[model samples]
Target: MPAIVEETVQPCPECGSEIRGDGRFTLWCAACDWNVDPSEPQPDAGRLERAGRVLARRHGEQLLGEMLDGSGGRPRRDVSAVAATVLALAVHAVTVVLAVGGLWCVVALGGGIGVVAGVVLLALAWLLAPRPGRLPEGRPVLLRADAPELFALVDEVAGAVGTRSVDAIVVDGSINAAVTSYGIRGRRLLVLGMPLWEILTPEERIALLGHELAHYANGDIRNGLVVGSAVRSLTVWHHIVQPLPHATGLEMIVNALYVLPRLLIGGWLILLIRLTSRAGMRAEYLADRLAARTASTPAAAGLMDRLLITEALGVWLRTEANRAALRGPRSTRRATDRAGELWERLTAYAASIPEHEYERQRRAGARRGHQVDTTHPPTHLRRACLLAGQSEPAAVALQAHRSDLIAVELAAARTEVARRLLRGVLDD
Candidate 1:
């Protein structure tokens, strides 16, 4: 057996209490929580965003309660889901009507004014039509040829989650990971944040992949094409009808004429989202369950714990980058070498975080009804759902050697991302 190394214990800078630091996360005093969360709170969101947050919190609480009481299981289509779908179809119907009406006006009316109005109506119809997502520009796209190991791993995870493999893997510097479909064919794209990926253990990385891929298997309504397009169309309608500020005379008249249309469209948008909110929350739970099933419960839970501190991780990266720039320009070989070590230091920083700090964040998340965003359920609920279930063995295991190979494949992209991040700070 290999020798076991002990964690380093030291006194807290804030309070003289013994604290242990591990190779995985930053060490902080359990008693004082000296460096638990050093990032500043974000500014308050807009009224519309706050309203969405409220709805998310409410839905999260309701679903959490149902799960705890054994009332919630697999999400099923209910009346609200049906109503939301109907509303989405209605939006599409309106788009179709506009197109037909525009054609009729140009063909039947046959006048200069009629042609102009028909052209305008046709433009509106085109604008409101459903659009396929596109691949992000200025990012590294990893193909199977370039990253066989990573692609193979993703394929394994997708098979475990009962979904098809993604077409490409895009890597960036942010501390996040997401899966999206792009182009007219809806080819799947998986975006991996290098900062977050560098900090995660191999198993945790698998868990992240499982969770993202599960979103596709789970039929998340909010992310679906029909409803998503409707939402976007409603938003555009609202914007077009919104009254311009400080308008004079004729412009003011135009603004006044659009007032009721704006109100009606805004109301419809809110109602559509509200109707789908519960279903969206349930989809998240279902995805979490699938992730747990694939990656094992413990790994899934660990991934959630890491997510709780993502804000802190982002702040730490920015702070370190700024500090490195302040030290001196990267003109020197030593400075360039130090800049390259940023990812290693970040990984260590994440590993040194104590269990107590995680517990603190978990409790705080529960109290605040913390969510990943307006679209996601509360982090506490998702974690609880994973822990409350029967434990599962990983369906897809990432061996040490394979993990090393994947890392090797990602080395070039990771270096480029790190360089860009450091360059941004250095330029400032």
Candidate 2:
């Protein structure tokens, strides 16, 4: 008889249990088969690759820690430090030269006042700016029971992108979702709105979660925090300058004059904010791509469309609230009845409009060629990208229908202002 050889089984990485081959090319571990890879690679090689991935993850953590804490035994900034020292010296020299010239007295007084004011204003800004501590941290608690499923979808998408697991997910009641990094070690939190949960389907939900996770993975959250902090610090100087005394009313006038300079600097600050914001939006798009790669492009597009619809409804609700408030209190019963009728009509009008029409109207408000808002690219563009292939038209349509159902449910909730008002009255 010819010699027969059988492939040997290896232990699973997650659990140290022996894996057995079932005639098929794939290996199955009786203990846990959470992860599966193609059988083309040798089992030992696969183990090594898994080990390499783990090592890379650890190395990445170490690098992140070093970047944040300036550790890792890296060389200190010798050249940049020297250059900064030289620049400071140059600035001092120029200031001295200007002070000694004909403009010396005014410059000296102005500089002294500006310095004092800047310090005070910076202190105030630090106090007034949104405190890091005040910001929500950790996983946000969701009141809705469907959160775990939502989280699973997020996890699946994040896993596909090789991003770290999210520390927590929170559901705020607002119609917004954001990713924030908090704490010294920089834990990530993904905050989704209640409406979003009610609006997005499982796949679309994954797409949104993927987008937010992308921000965390791409360091957008960290960069945004740093940039926002810097802007707040710089603008605090403006506040301090405004309070300084120059001469009688002249000091105030001089401070007012400084407004232009401050405004100019403010422009730079805004530019930085815009750049960061745009980067964030681009990160969102990239996340959409990742979600598509992980799930399907149509799924991502459907989610994007639903997100836009949710935003529009949210805006309309806010506008309606403002309009209602503007109507003021009704003195007479007739006036109150009339106001109530008008309010009902408005709400009914909003309810009657198809979501797609609302989306179209919102898109029309945008400048030509730009479908998505600058802060957020339009849904149509996202949908177009995802719908590039005709093979999945039915699948895409089904996903769209699912997303539409979610949106309708959420919009209905938002439309129930009377119910909310009734609750408030009952509570009172």
Using lDDT as the measure, which candidate wins? 1
Query: Whole-model Cα lDDT per candidate?
Result: 0.80, 0.47
> Per the 3 Å backbone cut-off, how many clashing residue pairs does candidate 2 have?
5
lDDT of 1 at 414: 81
Which TM-score value belongs to model 2?
0.48
* Candidate of highest TM-score: 1
Candidate 1 per-residue lDDT, tens place, 160-243, comes to 999899999999887889888889888899999988899888888999999899888877777777787788888888778878
**How far does residue 9 in candidate 1 sit from its true spot (Å)?**
14
Report the error of model 2 at residue 334, Å: 25
lDDT of 2 by residue, 1-428 (tens): 12122455677777888765533123444455423422222333333234333433333334334433434223233443334334334433433453344243434446776656555544443443433423343223432343444444456656766678656555444555777755656566667665455445565666666666665555443244545445454455445544465456777787777878666645544444433443434444555555665556766776666654554446544554455456564422233334333334433433443443434433442322232233444454445445553323111122455545544433433334233322221111
